[model samples]
Target: MRIVPSEISSRTRSAAERSVFAALKAIPDKESVALHSVHLPAHRYKRVGEIDFVVITPELILFIEVKGGGIAFRDGKWHYGRGDGRTETRTEGPFEQASSGMHELEREFRQAVDGLRGRDAVGGYLVVTPDVDLPPMTTYEPEHYLGSTAYAGGRGLEAAIRRAANHWRGKGKNRSALPTISAQLRGDIVKAIRPEFDLVPSLHARITDLEATFERLTTEQLEKLDELEDNPRLIWTGGAGTGKTFLAAEAARRSSARGTVLFTCASHTLAAHVAGVLSADSIVVLPFDRLDEVRGRRFDHLIVDEAQDLMGFGHLEKLEELVHGGLDGGHWIFMLDRNNQVLAPAGYDPEAWKYLRDIGAMNASLRRNCRNTKQIVKQVQRYTGADLGIPMAGQGEQVVFAKVTGREDEAAQLDRHLDRLLDDGVAARDVTLVSSSGDWDNTSARLTRRFSRIDRYADTIGAGKQRNRITWASVVDFKGLENQVVCLIDLDAEDLRGRLDAVYVAWTRARAHLWIAVLPGVNHALRELGVAALAREGAAE
Candidate 1:
C-alpha cells in the first residue's frame, strides 16, 4: 500500500489516529493508497469535519474514524477521555462522525469531479477504537466497527476493513449490483477528494528537501565544469535560477585544489554567502569593490560570479591586472546572467564581453534552471519576459499574487501571509521580505514599525547575527541569493516596470514559493503583460 503523504505528519496529535494510519500501511494490497486526515469544509449543520483516514483500494473507498484513549456513551451523549486525565463530551459518537464525514466526502467528490455523480462508486465508513474493546452496538453493523482486540499486529485491522468492504459489496440487490470501481476511477476519486492536501508537503519539509537537493552541483553544471579542463578562460551565461552562481563557486572550489583562487561577485551579500559555502584555505571570496585589498597581488585563477554587473572596460582591466598572467594569458572563469544586466549601475558592456571572447574564452549557455520550480518560472516569464531555462526543480507551491490598495494594505496583507506561513511550519529565516518600492521611505516606514524581528540581510550577514530571524533585503543586494520563500511587497507599477531586470531578479529569488503584494497599477501592468492577475487578494494559481 502507498500512503498519500508517504509519512505521517508530525502535527497529528491523536495516538489512535496515528495507529490506524500505521495499520493502513500494513494492508497487503500493493495498489492501495491511504490519505490521512482529509478535512472537509463546513456545510449545512456540520462545523467542518475531518475524516481520520480515507483508504482507496482497487475495489472500494473506505473512510475510518478513530477514537483514542477511553470512550463511553450514556444519556444520548459520548465521553472521550484524554491522556492528560481530562474528559470531553460530544453529542455525536465516532459512528455518527464517520458516517457524516463519509457522506460529505461523497458529496464533495461528486461536485468536484465531472461525470462522477451518476457513476456508482463503492465507499463505506468504519469506526476504530484502538484503546477500547467496545461491545457490539445494536445501532450499527458489527463488521463496521473495530475494537482494540481487532488490532492484532495490524492484520486484524486489515481483516475488519475487508469485512466492511465486503458488507457494502453484498448490500446491493440483483437489479442494482455494486459496480466494480476501476483503478482509473479510483485514482480520479482520490484526486477529486484531496488533490492539494495529498500532494503539497509542509513548507518546512519543502525547504529541507529542496535545499538538500540544491546543495550538490547538477549534472549539467558538472559537465560545464569539465569545459574548464581544456579552456581555462570560460564565460558562462544564463538567466535567473539557472545555477550560475553555484557553478561559479564550484569552479572556484575545484581550482583551489590546483592553486590560489580569487572568487568574487558584485553584491557584498552574495560574496558573503558564497564565502560561507566554499571554505577552501586557498580560495578568497570578496566583493568586486574590495579588489583593492589585493591591488598589487596576483591570484593563480580568477572566478567571478554575477559577472554581468562588472562587465565594464575599467572593471575588466582591473581584473586583468589582478590575475597572474593578465586577461589574455590568465586562467579565469566568468559566470553571469545576461538578462539581469540592467540591475547593474553601468549595465553590461558589449565591448567588454567581446573582449573576453576575443581572448579565446569559451562561452557556455546554461538553460536548465536548477533553483526555481516550474510554477515560479512560469510566473517570472509571464511578467518579466525572462525565460529562466526549463525549470528542473519540483512543481512547488503556486505563485501567489495579493492585490493591495496602499502601503497600509500591503503591510496588513504581508502580516497575514507571514502568519499563514508560520502556521505552515516555515521558519522565519526561510522567508526573505523584498521591497519593490523604488523609494525606501515609501515602503520602509510601515514595515519597520510592524516587524521588529526583521533584520536587513546585509546587516545580518555582516554582523554574524543569528539567522533564526527573518531578514529583509533590497532587490539588488538579494540578486544572487535565494530563500525557500520570498515576499515581494510594496510593488508600484511605474517603479516595477522601469526596473524589469530588478523585478526578474527579485521574483526568481524564491526557490520554492513566491508571494507578491501588488498595487492596483502594478496589477494592471502584469495583466497587460498577459499575466493573470489575482481575482482576489492572496489567491494562487
Candidate 2:
C-alpha cells in the first residue's frame, strides 16, 4: 500500500498511532493507499473526531481506530495505560468510537461530492488494540476487531482487513453483487479528507529554528555546571561560541537559590542581555562600570562573564570589593574566552592569571562550539587560529566574501546582499551589519541614506527589535552577542593588522550565515584565509 505522505509528517505523541503507522506501511498490496491521521469536522457528531488511519483499496475504504497499551473494560469505563506511567479512563470503547466516526465521515462525503445519492456503504470501521487482547464482546462482531494475538495466530492485519471488508460488503441490500471502489473515487476521497500543500517556512522562521538548536545546552556544559557542585570557584575558559553567556546566565540563575548572587560582565550590552535572562530577586546583574549601583553591597556569590576584560583597569579591585571575602576567600565563578581578550589586550594583565593560580581557583575548559555551524567554524579557525573545538552544529551555507572597489561600491554590494537575503526569506531583524572600524554611526548613516530599510542598532543584541528594518552595529558593542546572519562591512586589507581581532569577532558572530564585504585591496588578506573573492565585483553607483 502507498502512504499519502511517503512518511508521517507530524510528530505524534501517541504510541498506538506510531505502531499502527508502522504496520500500515507493511501492507503488501501496491494498489491500496493509506492516509494517516484523517481529521473530521463537527457536523453530525457535534464534536471533532479523527480517524487514525484511512485505508483505500479497490474493494473498500477502511476507517481504523487504534488503542495501545494495557486495556481493561470495567464498571462501564474503558481504562488504558497512557505509556507515561499514567492510566487514562474513557467512557466510550474503541468500537463505538470508530463506528460513529465512520458514519460521520460517510455523511461528510455525501455532502462534499456530487451524484452519490443512495449508493451502498463501501467502507466500514475496524478497531485495533496493539498491546492488549479483548474478550469476545456481545455488542460487536469478532470480524471487525483485531487484537494483539490476531497477528501471531492469523494472516495478520491486512488479512483481517480483507475479511472485515468482505463481511461489510454483504450487509447492504444489493448483496448479490459486490461493489468495487474506483481509482478516481479513491483519489477524491483522499483529497476530501485532507488537502495537500507544501508549507515552506519563512526565512525568519527558519532562523528561529536554528536559534533554538543553538540555545540548547550540550552535555559538556551540563557537566561543567555539575562540576561547580564540588568547587564553586572554578574559572571556565573557552573560545568563541562556546556558550559562555548561556553558561553564565544559567550559573547565575542556579546560584541565586543559595544566597545573593551578582552576575556581572565587562560589556554593558552583554550585562543587559544577561539581566533579561535572569530575573530572580536575589541575583543582581550589571556591568563592571555600574558597580556603584550596588555600593556597600556584597554578594554571597559572584558570576563574572567575559572575565578576561576585567583582569586590569582596577576592575578586579572593584569586583573584589563587591564579592564576599574578595576573590581569595569568596565563592565565585569566572567564565571567560581567552581568545576574545585580544580585542582588549591592554586591559588584560598576565598577573591576574598568576593570582588565580596562586589562590588555587579550580579551572575547566569548554571545548564545544555550540553556536556557529561547521562551515563557519572552519573559516573562523582557518583565519583567526582560534581553537573553537568541535563544531556541534551541522553543515551550513559557505561563508561569502564579496569584493568591492570603494565605499560607494561596498554600500551597493551590501544593499544587494540584504535584498537577496530578505528575498530569500530572512527577516530584517535577523541580519546584522558590523562595521570594522570605530565609525559605526557614520557607516549606519551612510547606509541608511543609501537604503531606507537600514538603521542603527539601538537595543541589546538579543533583545528588542525595530520590526521591518535591518540593524547596523559596531564591531566592539556587539561582542558577547550573536545573530542569525552577520555581514561584516568596511573590511580593508591595508588596515587589517590593526583590526584583525575585530574582524575575527565579527566573523564568529554569525550563527548560521556570514557575508564579508571586502574592500578592493583585500584579495591578499582573503587568500590568507583560503577564500577567493566572488568573480563579480560591485558596480560603483
Candidate 3:
C-alpha cells in the first residue's frame, strides 16, 4: 500500500519517528495506505492507549506502537523508554500488547472487508522502533513476535503482507496462487520506494565501548591507556587501594614518548614513589612549590599524583597557569580524594569545591580492597562516609576499640598493638600510621627509632624520598595515598575539631587492615558527625 506522509503530524512524532515515516513512505502499494495518528475511543474502565501510527489498506488494517528508545532485552523481556519528563510505567509487556493489538486489528479488518467484499481478509501488527540494536530473533511463537529491521526497508512491508497472504491462501486451498500473489505485491511496491539504509560500523560507538572495557580491566598494565587527543585535561579520583598511583604511572609511561612528562605531587613522598616507577631521564618529579620554576620549560603533559592536597583556588590557579600558560598545549592527569583536603587555608571559601567539577576527568572507583576484608571496608565506610561498593559475604576481623586517658597512653597502646601485629607476621612495610595532629612527631620518632621504620610525611613521600620501610604520617600528607595496613594514632584531639574530613582521609588510607587508637577525650566534632565511632565499629568484624 502507498503510505502517505501528510497524514501524520511533524510536531507529535520525534526525530526518530520522522525518520521511520520517511522510510515507510517509499513502500509501493496496490492501493493507497493512509497513515494517521487518531485518538482511540476513551475507556472509562481502563486507560486508553494512544496509537502512534495507523495504516488503513484496501483489504487489511494495521496498528503500530512505536518506541524510539534504544531497545534492551533482559530477563526474557524487552524494555524501552525516553527521557520525556514522564516516569515510564511498564503497563503490559511489549510482546503481549503487540499480540493483542494484532488480534484486534485482524477482527477489525475482517469486519471492514466483509462490509465491502463479503469476505474476511488479512491484517497484521507492527511494532516499530528506530535506532535499536535488537538481538536476533530465534522464535516467532504466539506471544514472542519480533520485528526485524529488514522488514522496515523497501520490500519489508510487502514481504510481510505476502507472508500473511500465503498463510491465508493455504487456508483457502489456493496454495499454488500464493507465489503469484506475492510476486505481484513485491513488483508493485519494490520499484517505487528508494531504500537508503546505511550499515557502517560507528567509530565513536566502538571507542566508547573500548574505554568502558579499559576501565573495567583487572590486570595492572601500562598499555592501552588513552591520552586525550585535543585540549587534553585529565582528573582521576579513587578511594584508597584503587590503584590511582599505578594508573598515574601508566599514564606517565604511555605519554612519555610524545614529550617531556613532568610528574608532580602535592607532597615529596608521593613524588618519590612515582619517581621510583618512572625513567629518571624522561620524568622530572617535583613538589607543587617547585612548579613555578619549571614554567619556562616546555612539557607535553603534567601528571599530578596527590592532587587531593592541592587545595584552595590559588593552588589550582597556579597549576592552571603552569598548564595553560607554560605548557600551553598540553594534558594533565590529577589524582584526587574528595575527603583529602584537610588543611584548607584560613578563610577558605567552601565555594571553591566547584573546581572539582572541571572537564577531562574520569572517576575510576576501586571496588575491591586487596588489603582489607569486606567487613573492615564496611565498618570504615560507616565511619568515614567512604562508599567502598563492596557487599559483605562472610565474617572478618573484628574492629577493636580502647579509650586511653591521654595522648601518651594512646600512643603507647598503638605501639603495643603494632608490636603484636608485627609478631603476628604483619610486616612493618605493610602498615601505615596516621594521625590528625602533626605534633605526633614524638610518638612517630619513638616508633621509628625502635622499629627502624621511617616516619612518612605526606608532602615528602611522593618523589625522590621513597622509603620502603613502614612509616608514620599525618592524614593531610597521606590524603591520596593508601597502604595495606593503617594504625591511626593521636586522632582524638579536642582542638583539632571540625576535622572529620581529615579523619575520613586517615580511615580510607588503609586498604587491608586498620587500627584506631582513640584518646579519652576523643569524642570530638568528627565523632559527632557519626564518622569516628561508626567507622571503627563498622570496620571491626
Candidate 4:
C-alpha cells in the first residue's frame, strides 16, 4: 500500500483527496458520531503531512494515503513511476514509507487519546494505488496495503480501513458515536486539501492553449488551404509516402462542419483500411461503385481516395451525378496521385486526366515529402516526373541500391540485407518488400519459401498493421503505405511500358533506404527515365 510521494503530483493528489472525501460521505454512519473526518490536527509534536482521507468512529481513527500509478515492486523495493518520463529511482521502498507514516500516526493517536477517559483507541494506515500492479507480501506486516488492479472493485483500500474499524468495534467501543467522528474527519480533510485541487481549472486552461498552438497552420497548411480552395470539382492529389488516407479522412472529419461527408475509394481493401481509421459516428463511407445508391442519400460533402483507378467518362459521370444529386451545396474532396494511374480496362480514355485539369478546379499538391528521406525521395524523383517543389535538408540517410543478375539471385541478396539491417539495429517492422505487379503474391511466396525470415502482406499495410519482423507487399498494393526501408523486386516488368512511373511510386514509399531488384534485360523506358542506373552491369543484356 506504500506509494511514491513524487508520483502523486500536487494536481492529481488534490483530486484523489477529494474523491476520498466524497466516498466517505456515502457511508451510512457518517454524520452521527463525528466519525468521518480528514486532515484533523495530528498531535502537536507529530510532523505535518496531508492525509488523503481520515475516517473516525468512536472506536477507531483511520489514516489513508492514496497512490495512483502502475505500481511495481522488485528487488525488495516498491517502484511507483510513470514510463513517460525518466525512469524512477528506487530509494526507501513503499513498505518503509507506509510503516513510518503509521508509526507517526500511532504516536498522534496516543496523544489524542490521553485526555479521553474510558475510550478505546486504534490507529491504522491504508495505502491505495488505483490501476497499478501490486506485489504479493513476502512477510506479514501491520500496515494495510491494497492495489486497485488485484482488487475486483475500487473499494479495496476502503475495505481495509473498514476491516480495522470493525476490529475496534468488537472491543466494546460505542458504535453510536461513529457518525460524529466521521463527519468531523471528512470536513477537516476537505479544508486542508481543497487548496491543492483548486489548480485543475488553470491546468485545463494551459492544456487548451497548447492544443490551439498545435492547430495553427504553417506553410504546409497554407498549401492545403489553396488545394482544397482551388478545386471545387473532384480534385485528387496525394503525396505517396505522406499519410494521404489519414489526411483525407481528417478532411472528411472537418468537412462535416460544412455538410455530410461521404468517403469512397477504388480498392475495397484500401477502402476497408480507410474505413477502419476514419469510421466514426458522424462520417459515412460507401464503395465507389455504389455511387448510384449514394446518389439518393443526402450529404453535405463528398471525398474520394485512390481516384487513379476510377478513370473514364462513366466514373466521372457517376461522381457528378452524386454531387449534383446528393449534395446540398456540398464540397467535393479527392485524394490521388495521377502518375499512379495504372491501366484502365480497354475502351477507357486516359484523357480523363486532362478534363479534370482543364476545368479550372483547385489543383493543390503536397510538396514536402514528410514520410520519406530526401535521398529516397530524390531517387523516386528520377523515375517519376514529380517536381521537387522544395529542397529538403536533414540528417536522414540515403536509399541503398542492391543489384542482382536475376530473380534467382534475389533470395541470397534479400537474406544478407535482412541480416545486415537487423545487425545495424533496424527493427523488422521498419523494412518492407514491394513487388512490381499483382503477381507479387507469387513473388512474396517464392521469397518466403526461400527465406523464411521475411513477412509479406497481399494488401496495403499501414503503420498500424506492422507487427511482424518484416512486411512484404506489392508496389501497387502498397501505394499509400510507407516504411523506413523498402526492397522493390521485379522492377524490370516487360508489360509495363511506363514502368518507371510505378517504380517512382514504389521508391518514394521508402522513408530511408530503397533496394530495387531488376531482371537482366532492363526496360528501355526505365533507362530513358534514368532509374536504369539501378540495374547492375550487363543487367540489360
Candidate 5:
C-alpha cells in the first residue's frame, strides 16, 4: 500500500541516490504502506528538506534519509565520502537534518492528515550505502519529536524497514481514514519505480534446489540452437560453463523425435549425465572410443559434445570417416570449447581442435555464459587471460583462494565448507569438490575416501539413486558440467602448470562460488598463476 510514490527519477537523483533507491525497492516491505520522496506542506516544500523514504505503518511511521557512498562520522563532524578513497566532502548533519525533517512532517500532518488527527508517533533514520562505516548510535530514541535514532547501511536497512512494517502489521490498523487509495496504490508505485530500481540487494547469483536456472539456456543460446537446425553441418563452440553439454542434450532430445540421434562425448561421466536427462528412445549416449561398435549404423544427426575431448583421442580422418559413412541426412554437429582441452596421456595439441573450420562447416560461437556468476567468470578470465565473455551474472559468494597444512586439513576444511554451503541453502548436489590429478593419493584418494561417505553421484547407472550429496569429481570428469559451489582442491603450482587448461576448466565449473585450495609451501607458483593465498585452511595428513 503506497500512499505517496517516490518521485526520484534518474534525472532527479544522482547515481548514488539511484543505487539507494534500488536497494529500497528490493526491501521486502517496499510496496507495503509507504510514503516516499516527499517534501510536504502542499507547496512550501523548500522550508522542509526531502524525506527519501517514509514507511507508513499502523504502529509507527519511519522517516528515512537515504544516502549512497562512504558515510563516516569522524573528527567531530559527519562526512560524506564519494567512495573514491579520497574526496570526502563535509556534509553538515544527516542525522539532525532527518530529525528536523520528520518534525516538520508530523507538525504539518497534525491537521493535513485526517488519520493522524491527534497524538501519533513516527521514527527517523539515515540509510547509508553499503560498506559505509556509520558511527555508533542508539538503536531507538524517544526524546526527539519523532523517534529518530537507528543508523543502518546495506542489509541492516532492510531489517530496520521490516521491523517497522511487522510492528505495524502486528498491531493492526484503522484503515477507514488511511492514506492508501483502494484500487491503484500498488500498481501506481510499481509502475513509477520498476524502471529506476534495477539491482539485487546483494551482487551474487544464488544456487539452490528451487533455483536451477544455472543450467538453463539464455535466449541467445536457444536462438543458436534453433539456428543450428537449418544448417546440415555445424561446429558450435563456447567457453566452459556456457552449456555445451546441455545444448547437446537439447539437440539429442529434439532430433530423436524425428529420427535417430547419436550423442557422444569424451568422458563417460558427462555421457551419463546426458543419459539421465535425455529419455528419448531414439537417442544413444556413448563415448568416442565406441565408434567402431556402431560402425555401419546410420544416424540422422551426430551430436558431439566436448568435441575437443573426443577429438583429443581420435583423428580428424576417423571423425571424417565416421561422418562420411554413418548418417541418414549426413548431418553432424560438434559442440566444444577449445580452452577445455585438458592434457591426457595421449592428447591432441590445441591445433588439432581447429580442424572443423577447414571443412567449411557452418560455425557459431556463444560468449554470454549461462553458468558461473559474473565474479567467478572474472576470476577465471583473470587467470587464463581468455575471452570467455561476460556471464549472465547472478548472486553468489566471491572467489576464495586458500592454502592449507596438508591433506587432513584439506579434508577438514572441505567438510566444514560443504556444511556451510548446505546451510546457506545451496543444494548438496550443487556442490562439487574437484582435483586436478586423480593419480595422487594425497590429492584425490584422501578426499575421495571422505567423499565416499557422503551421498554422491555414482559412476555407474545401476547404482541406486542418490540425492542431496556433495559430489566429488576429477577435474577431467567435470568437463561440460557445472555446480553451484565448487572447490578446486589439492591444486598447487605444479598441478596448475601441469594442466593450465584444466585450471581454466575447473574454475569455470562454479556457477556461484569458486574456492581454490592448495597446500602450504606450494602456493608460490599458484600465486603467480593469479590465485593468491587467502588464508591457511587444511591440516596435516
Candidate 6:
C-alpha cells in the first residue's frame, strides 16, 4: 500500500493526479498495489508530458498517465485551455504524449532493468480527469501500446485500471504472482524513473566511518600491532564480535609495509570475500588450506582470522610451514575466539593453543566486546548455555524476541524490525542479516532489495564497492565481521541443536541490538536464556 518514491499517505502534488490516485485506492485489494508518480523526465521539445502514475498491482505493472485540467481532443489533434470559451489551447495529443513518455521510460528501463524488455510485459494507458474529455486516437495506436488502454472519467477508472493490470497476467516469470513485483523489480523501476546515481549502499558509509572510530584497542595490542612491528609471534583472543579480525587486518596492513604479508581465513567463501575487500599492498588473502601454494615463497608476516575454524578446516602444520620457511623473523599473528561456537563437528583442542604457546607466542585477549552491546553478549551467553554467574557486558538494548509460526510470519517479523531500525537512524550498512535457514531466495527477496551477500570476511574496509546495502550473511559467512545491529532470522531449536556457537555468533554480531524471530518450537530453549516473546504492536498472534 505504498505510493512509490514518496509516502502513500502524503498528499499528491497535482490535483488531477490526486483524483486518479483516489480512484485507484477504491480498486479491490488496493492495499496490494503500489501507486508511483514516475517523476516526469526533462522534455526537450518544451512540451509537458508526464507518466503521471505507474501502478503496481499484485498482478502486473500498470503505467498510467494523467492528463488533467480542462482539455479536449477534437478532429485529429489535442487541445488545452481554461475552457472559459477562450477557444482552446492546442497542445501535444494525450495519447501521443503518454505513449512517447512511456516509450522513453521503456528505453531507459531496458538499460536499468535486468529481466525486462523481451518479456513484452510493459504497456500503459492515458487517462483524462472527469472534467476533461477527448475522442483521442485510442485505437489507432501501436500494437504494444493498446492493451486494454483507456482514457475516461472517475467512475469508469477502476475498470480500466483492472483491465490494464489483467492484460499482462501469466506472462514470463510472473506466473501465479502475475503482476507482482520482486524487490529487485521495485529497485529497477524506482531507479529508472529517478536520476542516474553513483551512490553505493549506506553500509559502506558506516564502514568507512567505523574505521575512524577504531574498535576498543588495548595498549598491549597496540604495542603488538604498531610498536612491536618486528614481533615474530603473537596470539590474539576475544569473545564473539571482539574485533579480532579487524585488528588482524590492521596489523597485516602495517606489517605489509615492511614486507609481503600472507593473510588467511577459514572458509573458501570467507577467503574469497576477504580477498575481494582487503586492499593492503603486498597482502594476499587466502584460505588456510591454500597456504601450501606459498610454501617456498617468503612472506614478511602472516595474519590468520578465525583460528578455531581454521584449526578445524586445515592443519596447523600448514600454517607452521609458511612461517618456518619464509619472512625475515617469522612475524605471524593468529586471531582466535572459539567461545565453544563451532558449527561443524570439528572442535578446537587445548593442543592447538599449546602448539602456538610452545613456539613462544605472546598471549593477548580483548576483554571487551566492541562489536556488540552488553545485552547482546548476555543473550549470546544465555543461548550458549554459559554459566549464569559469568560476567556480562552492560550495554545494548534487551534482545527482542518475537515468536513466529512459519516462514511467512518470520519474514513479516524481520521486516518490522528492519523498518524500525531504519527509522531509528541505523544506517543500512551497519546492519547484518544473519540466518542459517536454507530459504535464502524467499527470505532475501523479501528482506532486502539491495545487499552484499558476504560469503567471506573482507580483510580491509572499502575493498569491494558493490551497492552500499546491508550485509546479508549466512551464519557461516559471518566469521569475523561485526555490525551495529543484526537481525537473526529463522532461529529454532534445530539451529541450536548441535551448533549453539553459530547462534552465539549470530547474536553477538549486533553492536547495539539483536532482534530474534524464533519459530515456535525453538522458543523453549531460547526462553532459558531469559528471552520473552511478546506480540509486537498491531501484530497478529
Using lDDT, give the best candidate's number.
Answer: 1
Which run of 10 residues does model 6 get worst, by summed lDDT?
196-205
The lDDT per prediction is 0.75, 0.72, 0.53, 0.54, 0.58, 0.57
Off by over 4 Å in 3: 1-224, 227-231, 311-313, 324-329, 340-372, 388-396, 444-470, 523-527, 531-541
- Give the per-residue lDDT of model 2 (tens digit) for 1-541: 7664444423356667766776777778878778775221111233223577778887788888888889989999989898889999989888888988788876887666553446654878899887788999975798889988885422488888888888788774465576577777776665665431111122222223322221334657755665655575879989888888877776776566568999988787677666655657888988888889999999999998878877763777888898888888898998887875554476678788668756746788899987899999988766656668789878899999887787888888887887799899997778888878747545633753445666666463345332356777777777887878999887688656545567668889899999998887787875654331121112211
Clashes of each: 0, 1, 26, 29, 9, 10
Off by over 4 Å in 2: 1-214, 341-344, 448-450, 460-468, 525-541
Candidate 1 lDDT, 287-394, residue by residue in tens? 999999988889999998888888889899889888889888999998888775534435778888788778856888999998899999988777666658989987
Q: For model 1, which pairs clash?
A: none
The superposed Cα distance between candidate 5 and the true structure at residue 445, in angstroms, equals 7.3
Off by over 4 Å in 5: 1-216, 312-314, 321-329, 340-346, 349-354, 439-452, 455-464, 531-541
Candidate 1 TM-score over all chains jointly: 0.58
Clash list (residue pairs), candidate 5: 204-394, 204-395, 204-396, 205-394, 205-395, 205-396, 404-538, 409-538, 409-539
> Each candidate's TM vs. the true structure?
0.58, 0.58, 0.50, 0.51, 0.55, 0.52
Q: Each candidate: RMSD to true structure?
A: 15.8, 16.2, 19.7, 19.3, 21.4, 24.4
Candidate 5 global TM-score: 0.55
| lDDT of each residue in 323-417, candidate 5, tens digit only | 53432236788887766543232464555655565553578887777777878877776665555765776756788877678777777777777
- Model 1 lDDT, residue 153, Cα: 43
Of candidates 6 and 5, the better by TM-score: 5
Model 3 per-residue lDDT at 75: 69
Give the deviation of candidate 3 from the true structure as CA RMSD: 19.7
